[model samples]
Target: MQIVSALSEISDRYDALFVDLWGCVHDGVRVIPGANEALRAFRAKGGKVILVTNSPRPRAGVERQMDAFGVARDAWDDIATSGDSARVAMYRGIVGQKVWHLGYAGEEDGGFFTPPNVLDDPLEIARVPLDVAEGVVCTGPPDPSAHPDVMRPELLLAKTRGLKLLCANPDIVVDRGDRREWCAGAIAKLYSEMGGESLYFGKPHPPIYDLARRRLAKLADVPDAAILAIGDGPLTDAAGAMGEDLDLLFISGGLGAEETGTPRLGDPDPEKLAAYLEATGVVPTFVIGSLR
Candidate 1:
């Protein structure tokens, strides 16, 4: 991958850009340095930017959080989240079926039963026990370490009962301030490994990309070849871009810096980056130390 200093270096090649929210635009609590400015600059030059995120929350909820973080509205032309796509997927897949939800205790309304867009509702779902439920929907963990073991008994019960798992967020982990927390994908992946049916609705999955691509198309009639995907996660961003056949702009000093031997605070080591890309077997079209 060719290393560059800023998005402007290669921004002119694409009519639209699919940018990741968490690691590229902001860490959990605050905006990343120069990220908003870079996005605004890209847009100023007539590029449509879509904030495609693996966040478990819907676009409205994420937009509110971004607004609170002082992220300007002009930084992005549109937004799409894994939660929104998952809701659409679940609505179609589990019409009129009972499902048990596994997620943060207080965020019940965020599930498929009561989506942000009521027009897309396909069912009048009735909650049921794990053994009797037709499916299971996982948004994310309540705690930082909530993963395979934390939800093992429930997941096992669902597995034994043959309930399909709909994972809202395919991201395994994300930074919440200084702590890294496991997302719904961790449980879904474990369930699949144990011979259970699981459908992931986010990155590295076609469904979420389909939604994002539609949104991108609405903003501009850009082909997949002309769209650039920017992100930090190798598993989610890089894998998703490769799966969708889009070029990637990998941010080397973000989430996977340690494994890639790129320092978090300074310039990335090109040799180390090459090794990391070789080992992961996924290469981006370009590499930037930061979104700037």
Candidate 2:
């Protein structure tokens, strides 16, 4: 892979960018130093930047969190969250149908819910028993550390009922603060393995990328070849870029740094990093230690 120290070195090559939020821009707790500035600089040069994220919350909700983190509104042209795509399915008659929700809606977070009327009005699709629900909307486990075994019974029950699942986030794991935690993808994977029909709406999946491209095109008349996808997850970001036929800028120092024999910000071993990317089978156009 061609290694670069700064995004500015290759900024002129693309007219638009699809940037991942969780690992590339922030670690769920704080913004990565220089990451936001890199995007701002890209925007300053007339390139459109779309903050595409696997966050299971709606775009507005994700924006609220970004606002709390002090992310400048002008850093990107627009935002698209996995929840936005999943919500599309909901709005397309899914909400009117009896659906079940599986995830933790923090007491302070209004976008999450569970059975027993945990979801608020306009979002409380259906809270009926599993046998009565028509589909499942999995945001993630109720707890970060929740294992598949903890949710196997429920997923298996859904499978037995032949219910379809709308997975808001296709990420199996995410870096929260200083630790890795399970995500909805893990549960969805298990559900599919057990004969359930699960639909994912995030990176590495076509729907979110399609939505992002539409939004990006509205902001700037850019061709597919002129857009670059930047992220830290090899499986999600790199895989998604390849599937979408877009150039990828892999951030090796984020969540996948361990595969390169180091932690975030530590110097990556070139040979090991190459092997890691090869294993993933998605070669990025460039590799950078950080988005800086």
Candidate 3:
């Protein structure tokens, strides 16, 4: 992977960008400095940016979260969230009508139960207890700081009943301004390990990319070759881009900052970056310390 100084070096090569939110644009809690300006600059150049995120909030909720985080509206053209994509599946009754709602303990109204605009005949979803539910809809850990194994009792019961879990977000852990928290993917991974089926809809999965493509189509008919995927998650962003046959601008300074030896506003050490990428088994098209 080529280590680049800034996004501008390769921004002109693509007509659209499937930029990730939690890391590339914001550090989960707030807008990362330079990210908004970088995106605004790209938009001014006639490029469309789709904030393709694995956030467990619906697109509307995502917009609200962005607003609350002080993330500029002009920085992006549209959004495609894992919550919306998974909600479509949930409303379609992929996990049956009576399912358990697993989400963050104190997260705001995330619109996870809202019907997506795409469905014409959506089923009524009811959140039931795990012992009596048909399936599980896991948005994330009930407590972000708690260990994922804390929910093993519920998952074990669900597995015994042969329930399929719809994992809304596929991120294992996210750094919320230096505090790392477990996500839905970790719960789903544990479930799968315990012989329960976990259905993923976000990054590293084709469903979210398909949703993103539909959203991008509204703004421009950009080809995959002309659309660059930017994110900090090596497994989600890098793997998703590779799976979708799209080039990636891996932002190492977000999640793997320490591992890659990346400063807060500088490029990663080439040798350390190489070793990290090798360990992760991902080769991004380009690498940048931050969005700028």
Predicted structure with the largest TM-score when compared to the true one:
3
Residues 75-126 of candidate 3: C-alpha lDDT, one tens digit per residue: 9999998888888999999999999988842235546777777899999888
What are the RMSDs of all candidates, in order?
2.1, 3.8, 1.3
- Cα lDDT, model 2, residue 32: 80
Candidate 1: tens digits of C-alpha lDDT, residues 1-292:
6888888999999988899988888888888889989999999999999988887787767888898887889899998888888877666655227788777522433443554563455656666777778888888765657556777788788888778888888888887667887888888888898888888878988877888888887777888888999998888999999989999999887887776666654567877888888888777999987798
User: 1-292 in candidate 2: lDDT tens per residue?
Assistant: 6888889999899999999998788888888878878989999989999989988887767888988876778888898778778777665645346878788544354454422221344444555677788888788877769687688888888888878888888898988778899998988888888888889889999989888988987777889999999998877898999889999899888877878764565556898888888887868999887777
Candidate 2 TM-score over all chains jointly: 0.91
lDDT score for residue 232 of model 1 = 89
What's the alpha carbon RMSD for model 1?
2.1
TM-score of each: 0.93, 0.91, 0.97
Steric clash pairs (candidate 3)? none
User: The CA-based lDDT of model 2 is what?
Assistant: 0.81
Off by over 4 Å in 2: 94-96, 105-124
Model 1: ten consecutive residues of lowest lDDT: 104-113
Worst 10 residues of 3 by lDDT: 104-113
Question: Cα lDDT of all candidates, in order?
Answer: 0.81, 0.81, 0.91
